[model samples]
Target: MKKFILILSVIFLIHTASAQLYIAPGADLRLAGNVQVTLQNTDLINDGAISVPATGRFIFNGNGNNQISGASVPYFSELEIAKTGTGLLTLANDIRVAGKILFTSNLIDMGNFYIDLGSTGYLDGEDENSRITATGTGEVLSTVTLNAPSGANPGNLGAVITSSQNLGSTVIQRGHQSQVNTHGTGSSILRYYDITPSNNTGLNATLRIYYFDAEKNNLDENTFELFKSDDNVNWTNVGQSARNTSMNYTEQTGLNSFSRWTLSNAAAALPVTGLKLSGQWKNGAAWLEWITQTEYHNSHFNVERKYEDDLNFFIVGRKNSAHPGGNSNTLTTYHWLDHPLSNKGPVQYRIQQQSLDGATAYSNIIAIRPDVNSQFIVSMYPTLHVKDGIYLKTGGLQVEKMHVRIVDMSGRLMMTREMNYQSGWLKLPQLAGGAYKVSIKSGDHHWEGSFVKD
Candidate 1:
C-alpha cells in the first residue's frame, strides 16, 4: 500500500512482479496538469482515490491483457488504449473520462461495467477493428446539452442527432447487446442506442445511427431499418429516411420523441399483431389463452411456459395459425391447457409466433399463482419508468413480510432483500437501463413481474 501524490508534471511508470500497480484504500494518487502517465504491460487495481487534472492523460499500452478493477472508480481527463497484438483492456468497475478516449489499437471489453463520458468527452480513433465492446450487460453513456444542434454525435457514441429545436440536457447510452421485442429475443443488431432528452416533444428531429460492420452480429446490413422502442420490449418501425451501405449508417427523420433505437431487417416480421396472453385456473388446471388481431403468412404459434425458479422458457405446446396460408384481418384466438400443474407457486407464459419466412416474434408475458386464493393478488406499479424505485402491493392478502429477488434478463441475480410488505416502495439497486425480473415470495404465494429502467 503506497500513497503517491504527483503535483509536478511527470511521467509515472510501474514495473512490478505481478505486473499490477495497486493503489490501496485510503491512498491518494493525483496527477498534475499536463502530466502523462502510461502503464506498459501492467494492470491497475485502484481501491483508492486517483485524480487527474483536465489536461492530464492516462494511457494503457502494451501487449498484455490488462484490467482495471477496484472498489473505487478511476476518473481521468484523457484515457488511451493502444494495446498491440490480441491484448485488450477490460473494466471490472465503471470509469469516467472527461477529455477523450483514444482507441488506437484493440478493444475495451466492458463486462457489466459502464464507461461514462463527460460533456466535453468524445471517442477518438475508433474504427471497424478497434472499438468498445461488451460481452455482458455494459454500456457507454454520454450526456450533452444541445440547442438546435446540427449533426452532433455526443461522445461519438454513434447516434448523430440533428434538430431545429432545443434538446436541452440529453443522455445517449450505447450498448452492445441485441434487443428483445414482443417477439421472443435477439431481434436487433449487437448495437443499440437509448437517447433521452429533457425537452422530449414537439421537436422534429433527425437521427443518424452509425455502426461498424463487425458489430452487425450476423445480420444483413442491406435490410437494416431504424426501429424505436419506448420500453425496449416492444419496438415500432420508424422508416429509414436514408441509408449508406458503404459508410455503414442509417438515418431517420420526423421524430418527435426519442427512446431506445436499433437497426433490424425491414422484411423480418412475425406477421402477427396485437398479441395478448392471459391465464386462469379452471377445473384443477391452468387454462391459457391468447388473441391476435391480424395474421398474415403466419405458420404456427409456440406456447412457452416457465416456473418461478426456471432460468429459461420451454415450449409447452404448439398451435397452427388459424390462417396459415391466407391472411386474417379479424381476431384469432388460441387456447392451451396445462393439466396437473407441477409447480403450484407461480407460472409465466408467452406465445411465440413463427411466420412462413421463419421469422419469430413474442407476446407479452403473463404470470399467475394458481394455488393462491382467488381474492389474493399482487401487483407492481409503473412497470416501465426512469425512476429508482418500484412499488409493490399485495391486495386482499395480509402479508407482513416477503422475500424479493431481482435478476437480469440473463438470469444473473442482481439483488435480494427481505422487506415488510402489504404495500411498499422498494428501492432498486444501481441497475443499468434494461429489462429485469423481480420475484416476490411470501409463504405459499409467489409473484413474478418485470420492469424496464429507462
Candidate 2:
C-alpha cells in the first residue's frame, strides 16, 4: 500500500509538473502573451489525457479540432498559442497544459487540464467574449471546479443544440457536464431546436433546462417553458412549465404540444413531474385512426374521461405496448370502450400518450354526446351531391336487400329501392339537377345519406 501511495503521489506530481510551463529562449506561441509547454510528440495514444510542455509561444493552426499527426514536423522547445482567427487546440483525447490555460478562445479540453490556483495564480476560460465549445464522443467528462466568475454569478441561460451524429444516437445524458449562461441575457430569452412527432403529429417530450447561476454548480428545476412547431421555422409556446417548483417538473399531464392541444383550454392540465414531459397512447374507448412513425416501448398512452360538470379527468383505460428497440413503429387505429362516460350532456376525451421510458404526449380533444353512435345516427348510403349516374353499391356489408330511400333536405323520399341482401347495384331514377339525401335500412340496420344527382 505504501508503494502504491508513493506511485500515486508521483503521478500527481507529474500531472502538476506538465502544466508548469515556461517560455524558452527562442520559441513562438500565439494568442496569449506566451505559453511554455514541455512535451511534443506525434505518436501520442488516446488512452488518457496527455500533457503539453508549457514554455513559450506557439500556434497549433488548423480549423476546428485539427492536429498535425506526422513525423517531420519541427519541434518547438516552448509551445505557443495563437489567436489567428481561431487558432485553437482541441484535445482529440485528454491532455494537460500546466501554466495558464489562457487564449482568445478560452476553451480548454477539461479532460486534459485542471486549475490549481497558487498565490497570484488564477485559471480562467472566460474572457466574457469568446464562445466555448465542449467536446465529447459519448459523454465527455470535463470536471471543472470554477473558482467562480465575478459580476453575473449564477445567471439564467438558454441553448439550442441539434444532433446530427453519424450514429444517429445522440443521447444527451444528464450528468456529464455543467451548464451556465455566462452571457447574462437574463430576459428569459427562449431557445430550443425543433422536434416533430413520429407521424409529424406531436412529440411526447421531456423538457429539461439546466442553469448554473452565480458561477457555482448547475441548478435544476421542475418547471420550464415548453413549445412546439409544425415547421422548424415557426414555433408556438405550449404553456408555462408547472412541475417541480424548486428543481424539477414532469409533464404529469402526459402531454406536450400536439396538433390541436394549444388554444384548447388552460385548466386542462395536471401537476408537473419535473418541468419535463412524456407520454404515449395505445388504447381508449372510441376507435381513432392515425399514423405513428416512431414508437417507444415506454408506458402506453392513457384513456382519460371527463364527465359533465366535473371538469376533472380520470383514467379509465390503458393498453400495452411493444419494446422500444426500433426507430419507428405505427398503429393505424386506436379504440376505446368509454363506458366510463356517463350520458351527461357533453363528455370529453383525449389520449394520454406516454413513452415506455415515462415521457409523455397527448392527442386532440374529441367530444362525444352520450349514445352518439346509436341515438344520433348519420345517413350515408345515398349521399346527395354525388355525381350523376354514379351507381351506389355498398360493398362491405350485406347491402343487396336493404330499404334504400332518397330524400330531400326537408326529409322527402324521392326514390326508393329494395336492395337485395347480397351484392347488387342500386340505380337512381332521373331527377332534376338538385341535392337530396339517401337513406338505406335493413333488419336492425338503418343508415341514411345525402346525394347530388346533377
Candidate 3:
C-alpha cells in the first residue's frame, strides 16, 4: 500500500459547483512549506484529514458568499478574508488559526461556532467595515499569558489591559451581541468582552475597551460608561477614567480584578444640569449655596466639603431635593451654613446631586477663605483602626451633648448616635473594611472628618 498526499500551492479558483474542492473520508491533504492557497468563489468541503503548515497562508476571496463545512475542523496557519461584491465568509464549523486572521474586505460571520485564535494568533486589518460578527451564540476567543502588560491587546480583541502585576494566563472572548443585565433592562453595545485571568485579584489593572461607532446599537457615545459583571448578569458601573469619541475607546483604571466587561449607558442617567456652587464668609461661618437649573429623578443633594490641602472630600450635610418625586424645570436652590471649629486654610465645597437609582453628578467646586475666630475644635484619634471603636476629642467650646453621624464613601448613612461632648471612645457597628466619613453636629457648630477601617 502507498500513501498519496494532495498538495495545493497556487491560486485555487473554483467559480462553479464542479470546480469546488471536496475531500473524501479517507483522503488526506497536507500543505507544507510556505504554501499560498486562495479559494476564490468556492466552498471547501473536507471530510478527511487536512494538515496545514505553520507558515502557510489560506486566503478566502471571491465575489459571492462562501462556506467551510466539513467533518473535521480546519486548522490554518494564517487566514485572510478579502471578499468582494455581496460576499462574506461564513464558518459552518469551528476553525482554529495559529497565526493571524486578516480582515480586508468583508465580514466573517461565526454562526454558532467559534474562531479560536490560539495563544500566539491575533487579528489584523479589522475596521468598522470589515470585522468579525456573529448573530448566534458564537465568539472569538484568545488565550495569552501576560506579565505586567502595557497596552497589551491580546488577539486584538479590542480590550487593552495594562497592569503592574502578572496577569498570568488570560482568556479573552469577544461576542457581538447586546448584553442585558439580570434585570433585563440595560443593554450594551453590539460587542462585549468576557476576560478571565489566573491572577484576577490585586492586579491594579487599567482596561481600555475599544468599539466601533457602527456597533453603538442606538446608544449615545458621549454618555458611554464601562460596566463590569462577575456573572454577566448583574453589572456595575466601573466608571470611565477617560474617553475618546473620535478614537472609539473608553478607558477605566484602578481595577482590582477582571471579568465580563461591556460599554453601556448608566442605569439611570445623571439628571442634574447647570450645577453651580458659591460660598461666602458670613459673620463667623461659611455660607455655602448651590443651584440646579434642571433635575430629573432628583433624590437629594449632598454638600461635600474639604480643606484646600485635603485629599478627600467629606459629606457635611444632605438636603432633600425640592422636587423629590418628579422632574423640576425651574431653578432649585439649596443652602448650608458651615461653622467649622478650626480654620486650617481655605475650604472647598461642592454639591453632589444623587438620583433615585444611585446615579450621581457633581457640581463645580467653590473655595472660600473664612475669617472667623476659632470657637471649638474636634478631632478623631487613631484615624486608622482595626477595632470597632474610635476615640473622639473635643476641645475649646464645651457642649453637653452632640450628634454624630457616619457615612460611607458613597454617602450611605451607616451609623448615627448622640454622644457626650468629651474626649472618649465611641463604639461603632461592625462595618466592612473601607473608608468612611464622620460628621458631628452640635448647637451652632459642625465638624467633619474621615477614618479608615481595617
Instruction: Please report the candidate that would top TM-score against the real structure.
Output: 1
Model 3, residue 354: distance off in Å is 18
Whole-model lDDT for model 2 versus the true structure? Answer: 0.36
Q: After TM-score superposition, what is the CA distance of residue 213 in candidate 3 from its true location, in Å?
A: 1.7
lDDT of 1: 0.81
Cα deviation of 218 in candidate 2 (Å)?
A: 20
Candidates sorted by lDDT, best first = 1, 3, 2
lDDT tens digits, residues 295-335, model 2?
32334657777754455877877854443441232332444
Pairs clashing within candidate 3: none
Error of 2 at 231 (Å): 9.1
Better of 1 and 2 by lDDT: 1
Mark the 10 consecutive residues where model 1 has the least summed lDDT.
Answer: 4-13
The runs of at least 3 residues in candidate 2 whose Cα sits more than 4 Å from the true structure, single-residue gaps closed, are 1-189, 193-388, 395-400
Candidate 2 residue-wise lDDT at 90:
47
> What is model 2's C-alpha RMSD?
19.0
Which residue window of length 10 is worst by lDDT in model 3? 1-10
